[model samples]
Target: MNIIDNFDTLHRAATRKAMQRLIPLMCAIYFMSFLDRTNVALAKAQLAIDVGISAAAYGLGSGIFFIGYALLEVPSNLAAHRIGPRRWIARIAVTWGILSTAMMLVQGEWSFYVLRVLLGIAEAGLFPALMYMVTLWFAPNDKPVVVGWIYIAPALALMLGSPLGGALMQMNGLGGLHGWQWMFMIEGIPSVLVGILLFFKMPERPRDARWLSAEEAQALESRAAADAQGHPELTSSDWMAALKRPTTVLMGLIYFLNQVAFVGLYFFAPSMIQQMHVKSPLLVGVLAASVGLGFLLGVLILPRIHRRYGNDCAFLGMLTVGLIAGACAFIATSSPAARMVLLAVTAFFAGGVLPSYWAIAMKRLHGIQAAAGLAFINTIGLIGGFVGPYLFGLAETVTGRSDSGFYIILVASLLGLLLVPLFAKAIRRETEASSPLGNGSAAGMQS
Candidate 1:
């Protein structure tokens, strides 16, 4: 019993050490990625004046990044599996950073679209690669919380990036560059530097981490192996089968709808706030940061809820509440302050969904399938990243009302809410089938 106790202590120590060493670095890297992705929103009005980009064109340019992203995601994940995440992620960050910085050179719509797509290509596979790394380094029980931490990067990016982007935008006419140009240049440079940091700092796997003692490393590896036991590594032949699984497909669809609401808000919230007659760029950014703060609160609050209610309960509950908040944004259209408040409320609950969704999705995936399946789901869902912005743009341009686009958010949220029951049922079934006692006995026990 003492020996067992000692082992448990060592395991906990290793997990703690790994989290301390890794999570911050990973979050920093992802924070840069998301900041670069969405900072375009802050630059939209300037782009229209300086670059002749229309609302529709801006939407397409903002979202077309995902087109390049989706195309390369699977290939990139497979390559990461082969070459190691440390190197692959560094390559992605450097290339995307270079491209993000180059946004300063946009001469017209074509250049804008091309640069955004290239940036997407450069950043492709990053999220799934990070998710794959989590599977390699952490045990099943620790994954949801770990993923929750990783998801915080985007919220932080928005929370901090909005204000930072605003401040940078104030750099207009400094050194003969527009404020947006300055924003891109300053923001993009750090990612390249961070990429360099990652190449040197990131370990390929838990067993390779020099910070961990040999016994601790062994404990981590043993825990990971045990976690992977039931879900065997998929061979190439089984790759398509794994991707085609009903649960995977359903989760992808759910994420797609969620992204429709989430990404739309990410790309347009600044403009939406601008429509509220608040003319100052910095003020718009500061107000926009409120949404990020709401999201940050949600991400921070979810793990406690998860601990108390379990995964399914936490996931469905947050998603349902989030969707409701999102739908209510439509009703707040008459009041700018109310609209902003609803947007933040929507973000707060929406923030919880990503971590919770992945927490459940990760359980059904292991080994090579974890990489492939994650990329596949992300690829499908990211297409909505494109759809959301494009449709919102189209809606706004056609109707000439900024808030009119909330109709899309309303419909998407309702559709997402309707699908939650189906997703919950599927997850329960998968969990039952995978348990030690098998599906029949698990069902019997539940009954």
Candidate 2:
């Protein structure tokens, strides 16, 4: 018993050490990715005025990033699985950074579209690759909290990015460039530097981590191997099977609708705030930063709710509440102050859903299925990232009102709410079939 207790102590120590060392770096990497990806949303008005781009055109260009992203996501993750996430993720960061920086040279709509697509292609697998790394370094029980930490990057980006993006936009006349141009160049540079840092700092697996002692590394690896047991690693021949699993498809659809609502609100929120007659660019950014606060609070606080209620119940509850609140916020009031408060409320619940959702997802997938399957799900869902912004843009163009796109948000949220039960049922069916005793509470599936 003492021997077992000693090993358990060592295991906990190792996991704590890994989280401390790895989560910050991972967060920094994703922070830069999301900042660069969404900073274009802040640039829309000025970019349109300067380049003669219409609202519909800007929306299409903004969303076209995800088309290229979806196309390469699975393949990029497969390559990361083959080559080690360290190398692949660094390569993705550097290339996408360069492309993101090149946005400074956008002379017209076509150039904007092309660069956004190329940037998407470059950044394709970073998210899932990092998720795959989680499987390698941590046990099943550690994932939800760890994933929560990793996801904080985007919220931090949005929070900080708003002020930073606003300030950069204030640099309009500094070097014969527009404020938006300056914003892109300045924001894109850090990703390249971070990529270089990742190449030197990131380890391929627990055994490869120098910070961990031999016994600790062994403990981690053993835990990981145990997690991977019973679950087969994905291979080329069966990759399609993993991708097409009922659970996989349903979760993908849920994520699809979620992104539709999320990206629609995200891409347009600043403009909506602007339409409220707050004229200053910086103030718009400051107000938009409130959404980030809501998201940050959600990511931090809501997962604890999941731990209390369990994954399925927590996920459904958060999504249902978030979607309904978000829809009502849009429909209930046109008052700027009230609307901003509601927007943040909507963001709060919306942000809570992701960490819980991914936690549930990672539990169901293991090994390369965790890598490729996560990528496939993300790929399928990211198409909505495209659809959301484009449709929102089209709506705005037709009605000449920025808030005209709220209908899309309403429909998408309702559909997502309806799909929750189907997803829960699919997860249970898969879990039951995969368990040896025809019961789903297998050791491998335990949270």
Candidate 3:
């Protein structure tokens, strides 16, 4: 395969300009992704009070979505690989949109549980599907930056979802629907519209993008393929082979460790803050939004940090910083403002290191292999998504303190810092081969 001539020298402006068209769409999709999933967090206090769902039951419902999400991941990824991303992604968005809207209809614990499961089923492989699409557009060295962009979607979601959710909750008795109902109705519409947009506007591959000139498309495709040739495991389409890789298992572990802290804290952030004696929905929204803002700020500065610090140093450093900041929550237990600042600091590190972690993972997988490997990794990691909230709720129930659950954040950060280097060491040769830092191409990364 002919590598794109001067891929090492591709102009940063050229690459950025090309991606500018596609990433905004992805960011929008991710905005919907997190919004639909976590909007429930915002609605939790009112929904529980209205529907008589217990704390444990609510946690179960929140986490149950990931069960369906995990179970169907490989299958969904295989389907997406076979059918193409536009159709599969659009299909996911529309179905999940319907389910998300139907959340307003939840009348009891069982209804809430059922809808959560269904929502999970609808969103099963969305992440892997999008990851597969990214491999088609970007080179290995570029995947981290791309990963950062996708996450900015969630960061933006928090910024928007918190305020929107708070405001909508004030609309109680509108059309005989609660404010939470209105929130669901309004938030769910954007997803369906995005689905329609995906079907009509999203291209299956670079070659199919009408807006990209032939030279641009070829450059993207050639560079992507060139990176894959050095490591077939990085882009192979074989799902079974992907599942069997040791690295696949390790990457999943890393994600699981990370999520054990992040997702659980996130799922209950608003109500937990309320437990600090703060009652205003608008204030809760603002505080929650700050954590997301921290995430966005971290991602915005990440590429520069990675360039300056090297990926390994940058990765471990963020975890250490987050660990210190997160543990401070226990110290600031009485001060809501201090707690928010600490959580925001924790969010910064969690968000900052994600791209580097994904960059390492993507270096070893691409295409169908990437699809299946990512699905498997995500499937396992999402166990944390399920476990985090439920476990937090259980812990909170047992300990009689909402803040008790947040201790997991520090534990997770410590584990990640300790385990990541070992995982990287185990795959030393592969990382060296694919890592721009190892090959002295770090300066060429953005280009």
Candidate 4:
């Protein structure tokens, strides 16, 4: 065979490997991404004396991670867009791993603050880059499930990582190192290894895959072309225009409010369990794991629900149910059943949101336009993401009760409930005005 034929054969093989490679890679990295992000939660609860950080200081430390994360969020993603995900993602993973392991050295509030900030900086690119990669590789029809799968990472981390975190933290005999320090060291090391592995495995883009045949590459390129038809070429102006759109703004607001509830619960859930008279850190981990179970179930079920009710009804109904259940949980903190019910409801809704959000965005946007749009939405959303945990911690410090944070979440959930309707109205109008594409196809993605 000629060189051209050899290239074609290789490209085809690479294309075939994409889905299998992509899903597992995303799952593993994000699992560590989450574990690294919340190792501090475990640390705060159990390593308090070891770390020498106060509760209020802990909240500040938690919130500062997001500020650090927020500072670089857009820029890191933009860099990923410019440099491609493989190298940038590897850099992020390795950097976070080093910083996370260094948490062992933190002896005071200042060191903890510095380390958390570094962790945030390390994590900045991950989610936006993942979303960007998905847009590059998957068709709009296949996006919901793929995105849903990626979104399951955090949940799985909670389910699996939580118990593991508790166990590692109990490793105080492994030198003079504290349990909390070990938590960071153990959680962060695997990410560094994964980063090295990513260098070898993850492709820069679909076209860069050397294992795909010419026919396969052409097919993938064609699918991308068809999806690009209705969308304007991605430009700075286009990005600005998308942001200026009332609809985009509405979606951002809704996501922001939603994160306030979701992120707050995640950061504080362990502490909440600890305060509920559950003396065992392992037991607290188990309860938090339940939320993770809810998340997995939510992602698994959203496709069927979407097929049944359509995106608009599915989303609005989920938010409404979420708001009600969230409120009940906050109000009935004394009742374990009520609190668990609320946490499950919240996780389910949170889990389902990413898939629907991506599905809607994919149907509406394509190419770099989708990447920029996801970045923008996520950037705005992280504002709340950053705020939620800090506010929760701060509120708990001030009030001496962590339940106040949940009540705050209850209010934010209501805001999310209110915003979803407006988003639906605007989206419906946009769809009606434009040529609405129905459910996209797997073939449609590879067009």
Candidate 1 global lDDT: 0.83
**What's the CA RMSD of model 3 in angstroms?**
3.9
lDDT of all predictions, in order shown? 0.83, 0.84, 0.77, 0.72
Give the best candidate by TM-score: 2
Per-residue lDDT of candidate 1, residues 65-173 (tens digit): 9999988888899899889999999999999999999999998899999999999999999999999888788887788789889988999999889989998999999
Runs of candidate 2 with Cα error greater than 4 angstroms are 228-238, 311-314, 439-447
- Which residue pairs does candidate 2 place in steric collision? none
Worst 10 residues of 4 by lDDT: 438-447
Reference-based lDDT, residue 416, model 3: 65
Worst 10 residues of 1 by lDDT: 438-447
Of the two candidates 3 and 4, the one with more favorable lDDT, higher being better, is: 3
- lDDT rank, highest first? 2, 1, 3, 4
- Give the TM-score (vs. native) of candidate 1: 0.94
